[model samples]
Target: MTLPSALLLAAVVATLWIAARSWTLPAFPGRTDFVLMQLSAAWWSTAVAIESIVPDPADKLLWAEMAWLGIVCTPSLWAFFLWSYTRGELPERWRLALVTIGLATWAVALTNDAHHLFYTAVRPVNAEPGAALVYSHGLLFYVVTIYIYAFMVMSIVVTASGIHRATPAYRTHYLGFLVVMAVPWAANAGYVFGNLTLFDLDPTAFSFLMMDGIFYWLITRRRLFDLLPVARDALLDAVPDPVLVLDGDGTVVEANPAAQALAGDHAAIGRRLADLPGLSALSTMVAAKPATVSGPLTLDCGGSPRCFEVTWVPLTAGGGGREVGCLLMLRDVTHRHRAEMRLEDTVRRLDLARLEAEERLVAEQEAKRALNGFLSMAAHEFKTPLAIIDGAAQLLLMDAEVKAPGMLPRLEKIRRAVRRQINILETCLADDRLSDPAFALRRDRLELPVLLRAAASAQGDAAPGRRIELELDGCPARMTGDGPMLELCVHNLLNNALKYSPAGTPVRLHAWSERGPDGQSHLAQSHLALSVADQGIGIPDSERERVFDRFFRASNTGTAAGSGVGLNMVRRIAALHGGTVTVDSRLGGGSVFTLRIPLCEEAPCEDRMAGMPAD
Candidate 1:
């Protein structure tokens, strides 16, 4: 045997050895093993066919047998790889089909030797000095080449599609295998097509050898076959709760299939822990300390509310050194936590109920004491006024001089004082009348600015020494409401302003139509605003909020003689008219009290018929 024959025999032996190993290799030996085997077989067959066509008759039958074996094995190996990868299932029908195809191809090649169809003849050539070679081709030879090329393309497509369908975990393994498979297939096609001409340098055999190394490395290093058990164990372990391994920065470094099942079907790896519900707070807690906390947590998995007892512990080495990350174990504690919270709430409510009962008892006792004191004070006030009226009437009746003009004036003064005292008593007794449901409003229309002017006039007349001013900026339009009540609101505001302000300072009653942001004029048709401002000792900031409360008195008013009910009454009347009264005041800078009212159009006719004074 020549050197070529020896090399061919060695290549064929290597191909068979690698093929047998691939059947049970631990990891994907990649396409390199199959591709190398195919190339070796093809090389042997083509060499034998060429050698058979030569004039040399020695070993012609052996070369023909070798060529036939190569032809049969190449497609058989290619078909096995294609079937295993693409379909992911190996059925008896597919195996039988592959066997039948291989036998048919081998039989056709054998028949070509007798009938000169597959390969017509072989011609020996000495193109290069001291080199012997033969070239052979036939009709069936070209047809087989076409079939092989078509099958190679189909294999590439199927393998690539299968790789694409694989999970991300297995993608790298499959892709590496694809590269190993593709290289030799491409080299074989190049060789068959005469595109490659490297003497004694068989790319097919080299590719297979490279693929064998790849498969060995994959099996030893990647441990692809071990993944199934690991994945199964991970799923079984994660079935109880959401199990996750987080990096220091709060990213999900690893998660099992169960974690995915609980959280979401989306890829969780490398996603920021903060992005997941309930997990973000865990990150914060871990940063602070290793402790357990139970709370209500929401998860995006299904927007389900879960209660979790989150346990955080630092991962430590044998020497008590801190590891790079910490383990977070979450246990569903919703029912338990909720029950505890409900118990706490029940205790708090019971305590509050007990305290409220105590407060009510104390308040009842206080009310009794305050009623006793109020009655005594009321009796003393009533007795003094009654005694003065009695004494004045007795003096008038006892002396004829009491009937004189000076005596009558003193008598009138006594009468006025008694009336004032009676009014105070009436106000106190009728306080509950304000809350009466049947306290109907006597509505009417009156010019607001004119009424304001009249109230200012009356205030000035009552205190002639004080100067008052009226700054009526808008139309003196009529508004509907109870004229007397509206006038009383104006009067009380003016009185409070005068009583608090210094003498000789201007007391201004201002009315205006203002446009608001809603593009509606406040006093255009339905609403009116009137302001009574005083240049007096303004209310203190602390007391401003309570100024409208009944019996609320400011400390700095310096014993100004007036009931604190004026502003309260003003607020009540404004509210009755579907309006509100607000105060804008600063201490020592005087106060601006604004009354907003819903206008009544029919107030003028009613006021005129009732002989009521109009503004």
Candidate 2:
């Protein structure tokens, strides 16, 4: 065989092998049609190659018939392949019809010799032995040629439509298919109409071999049949989060619909991220480090500031861990960011308020300590002078009584005045000591009537003109409590009663002990109530509750020479004994101050003030 013929035969063999291999590939859209089209191409190339080197006209005609059989089937198979490739599968009926038509055309061509329909006359073009045959016009040949031309036009339309619909990445593959298919059509047209011949053989077979090679190259190198572009489009385009595919240099290679909108109106492919206003910060981050996922990146998107969490995904080549590209995903986090800012602001305000309150509390406590120290020092100083006056008054009273019996009452008044002053000083000293929480109560069993008599006698001595009386009504004879504090509490009440009441009015001390509901209502318990009743100026309704507050003086105690701490101290002492003090008064009708203490259980005590100390 000649070298050219040998090469052509080898090409034909390779085409057949490729067609067989393509048919065995896993099924996908247009898979069967692709295999059928390739097989038709192989068949045509084989017959044409065989016809080229044959010597007999009859043998050439037989080979030409075989070649024509493949030729007639080629366009229909190609059309079906486009239908499946572009539109994802033809209807079953449409596929069947195309197959039937191709088979019928081949049958008609087989009997063409009887009627002179396919070829009117046939002869070799070179008039040399082992040269390819040439054909003259026949009716059947023209009819089949027109049918094939229609399919060719339809395949072109299908491929063009496919290219239009393809992604930017896959459009080149569809264009390659169109260009390869056109090569055979162009070769066929030149041989039939323009009389262009190559090496005394039809060039259509060579074009078919070239087209098959292109198909194999496109499928292998470009992965044209994998349909990954479709998958990439379906998943990435439909996602709401902005996604970007970047090359190793951080240039944007592909962007989805959301990313395009985020980047503003422009083409994104092949553009560097730094060129975009919203994504420039991301570009800077990626440039610094190949892969990093840090977020809450703020950007102005379409004139509105929004927060987004950015994720940087490294795209590696296969499993080799070689860095190839990157993927950026941005998720919106505006609401969460705003909420965090608000919470931080709220915490700042609360911290300021807490600090201010702490400062105020510290100042108040310091002032109270200063006031308590002043009271303690002043009471101690007054006691010294008060003791001297009381001793001098007693000595004068005795000397006056002995030397002049007529001056006895007047000197006795001087002694009572000194005693009253001493009593007031003692009250201040007791109040200072009671301010200390660690000061223990002095508990003892003492009769309420006896304490009441003693308090009345002291007040009667202080105010000689005032009538003092003791009224005892079923009062307990004895109870356990702090005797000195109780005596001070009663003495203060008696002083107020005698001091405020008119000189001739009666000041009554009423005492009672009874089984009744404790003020706190803890079952029935024994109680002793010591009341100091006087017909004096009374407390008003408004200041009733505040009468027991420290340093609170009644409004209507007109020009009354008294310290305001009396009632407050009384209330404190009563509370220390698990008791309470209250008042019932009317304007101009006078007031009754009552101290009720719960009685303690019977116990033997050697000392009168067992639980209390004099200090």
Candidate 3:
């Protein structure tokens, strides 16, 4: 055998060896392109071998083999180039179509030769010195040759363009494949142009064999066979749970069949880990440690809930090199986790029930103690008012100055003080009754502006000299609630505003009707937002949230007497009416307390307002 033939035989043998060996190795990068290129090169070598052996100048078998070889190798070469160019992103349909077309062409060519329609005869002869070979040319033979060259050129151009568009990581391998493909392509062009003949030197076939050798070297250097075998086995294997491995850069370097199955058939490999759903926490866990760690993870896999116990271990290169990637092993633990959670929930409920029983017992005892303390405080509060009444009455009876200039005013002050004290006691008793748990709202439709006016009038009567202004804008809207309870809430808010604000500051009470989002007619029915703004020393920022708690008061508002239950009562009443009370206040800058209530349901009006109540 000559040097070229010897090289061809070696290349063919190596191609078969790698194809067989690739089934066993762990799948790694660049393996599929390597395998496909090997097969194409092997077929090309078989054609070259046949051409060298056949002595006939116009041998039909020799021409048929060349045409069949071109048909088989052309698509395979294109596919390999595509895989190299795209880094394996070429769609499966494109590859299948190419292969199908090549095989159909081969079948037609083979049938034509068998029927003697394309080539008629064969003859053997010595052609030239040291170039003992056969050659053939016919109408169909030259036509197929032209088609093959044209197709190869087109495939190469497309492959080259795809290669240029590839990412930087795969560009080197694509460029190398391009050069290898270019050599055979250029050699064939030279032969066609008569610059070189098959008898003189088959440099194209020799160069092709060299390209195949270079491909083998590159493949073995990167252990590309490893990737092919892993991919094949993963497709064949059946594992229970999703499993994947990630490189140090957090790209999914490998995934098993089960992993792909769980990930919804999406391509898992060569994609960044962060791009995958429900994998962010796993990535974070692995990155934080960069060492072996195992824990439970809850994930929404698509729309279905899944739980996993994932173990992550760092992967190291050979010779004790630093860590390069992580090997993730996932085991489905959804059933186990749910079982454990159910048992824990059962125990927690039992504990909570027992704690609640204890709390109820303690609450009853505290209520009894509170009642006793309240009675003592009530007696003291009543004694002062009773003493003032007794003193005023005795003065009126004994003094002839009862009709003096300021005598009547002093007596009225005494009476007002007694009335205020009585009102406080009555309010406290009502509040206690409302807290009895059996209390529920006796809801009814009532005009909101009328309620506001009544509340403002009562506050003005209580604080005789304080100016309480009412700004009733638009028609009076109505709301559904216990009229007495709502009145109490409005009364308390206005009272607190007047008590806290400086005397002579205009206490503005406003009422209005407005629309809401729900398009229903809230006729005379709207958010009766009664805002009692005070130009008083407002509640401080730190104490704003606590102001609604019973008995809570701002320490900075010195000597300002209050029971501190007014705002708390307002909140409870708002909650009862399915509404809420909010305070916008600044220390030393006054406050606006808004009571938002849904309009009463049955109030008559000419036009119905359209909107939902503001909360």
Candidate 4:
């Protein structure tokens, strides 16, 4: 039996168990990459374990190549994990460069047939079971080994460098990390240079089991910095934004340099909130204890006054979760405030009320036109990148069919993603434009039956294969709304149902008038309800609330082309009518979008806009 192979498998299992436990930790400080490291090591161990006992030379060679995927990444991931753990961040460029070199190294190892730069030769026959694959290391293999050790040494040096400045609690954690990150590489180096082997197998993979054990102890017993506060020097102090924390009694327990400078009290700690005259307006909100943003609190900083908006939230602790303190973040809004003041002064200097009103109206109209044009132009600009990607994919498609057949479907997926983006671009822009106040609602009396029937018929015509059933017999004949906007809403809703649901499915369009709760129209304002129900892929329960939010698509709507803004546009239109829109949906069962609008009741007036003077 291959005892080394069994131990290697045990290493794989133990590492994966730790990886599972690590998932519950917070995201940053290399927590994500830490789990990735474990998973990568687990696979490497599994491959090496299998390679030890496999009888066929071809099979052994395949597993050896597979192991290189994890091997090439050993140093880079270690360096990144240590840096992120100690410093809380690694620059994106460094991460990209490391990953690129690692993957390129793996690729060279993978296709060693063409160049043989990674391994000069590989075979199964020169050794017994439970032994390393028979292979002659090439120049590139040693080069990559040096590359790995470079990162190993660099990580140890960088982590230890910060030890003096780190708090006493974190300095020990730093030392522990340097040990945990370097052990496997140390074993790998020993195996290559000093012939350290377990039952004729490389000891590198087996060392991970010991590394995982130490990593677990560091996290649970020694209190690794994953859950600790931001590193005082790199983050809390270096940030330009002012931050302050107070105890329950309003004593300033902590204040960053920016916060102290903003308050003009270098020694703000231990001072009560009431004593800080700069925070008088903020002090009043403490009794209320609401987590909210308030006030442009003006601070007289040595004659140069600065205005700040306070965003505060209650910080609670202990068993009963009693309010322990509050954290305050101050954002300087002096420039915006000064701009407003300047605009007000300019307005006051203007001639007369009538001229001001005329000028304001003209300015608003011009701004609206310019804004709409800009949004459209910006949306189109996004297509330039997408088009470039699509063209590249198209060129690769012909090449991929011959050289890399497996990549054909991936290229097709990219093409599909590009086309979907194009389809949704206009709707996204249109929904974005809806937020402008200049896109005013012009409500007019509308015949409900005529309007709804026209919409359903048009949608049905466009998608000729499906049935759009209209239930409008009980609906009241008249309502008030923006005619074009209402038509747009109906079209959007209908389009979503048809697009998401399977072809030839019947989509029910129901509209009816609801009498007052007392069964008298005069007692309360009468209302009308309209619904579109489709038996298509329904919205997931978690996402139902956000389905009408701009650019939110249901997770289940896969590969069905859709502009996520359709429902959001419907909601905006509904709001303009002084009504509400909501969805009732279930996964695989379909969705019902209900839009309820208040019906006009006073004297059943016709289109009032016809006789009313324009603003």
Off by over 4 Å in 1: 1-65, 127-132, 166-170, 195-221, 228-615
Model 1, C-alpha of 484: deviation from truth (Å):
84
| Candidate 4 per-residue lDDT over residues 454-478, each given as its tens digit | 8887677556568999888889898
For all predicted structures, in order, the TM-scores are: 0.36, 0.50, 0.40, 0.40
Full ranking by lDDT: 2, 4, 3, 1
Q: Comparing 1 and 3 by lDDT, which wins?
A: 3
Name the Cα RMSD for model 4: 36.9
Residue 162 of model 1, lDDT score: 58
TM-score attained by model 4: 0.40
Candidate 1 residues 556-603, lDDT tens each? 977678677767777776766667789999899999999877555543
lDDT of 2 by residue, 458-545 (tens): 7778777778887786778778877888899989889888877777889888787766665456567778878889898888989887
Instruction: Please report the TM-score between candidate 3 and the true structure.
Output: 0.40
User: Residues 73-123, candidate 3, lDDT per residue (tens digit)?
Assistant: 554554445444334445567656656656775676666656654455544
**lDDT scores for all predictions?**
0.61, 0.77, 0.65, 0.74
Residue 133 of model 1 has an lDDT of: 34
Error at 501, model 1, angstroms: 91
What TM-score does candidate 1 get on C-alpha atoms? 0.36
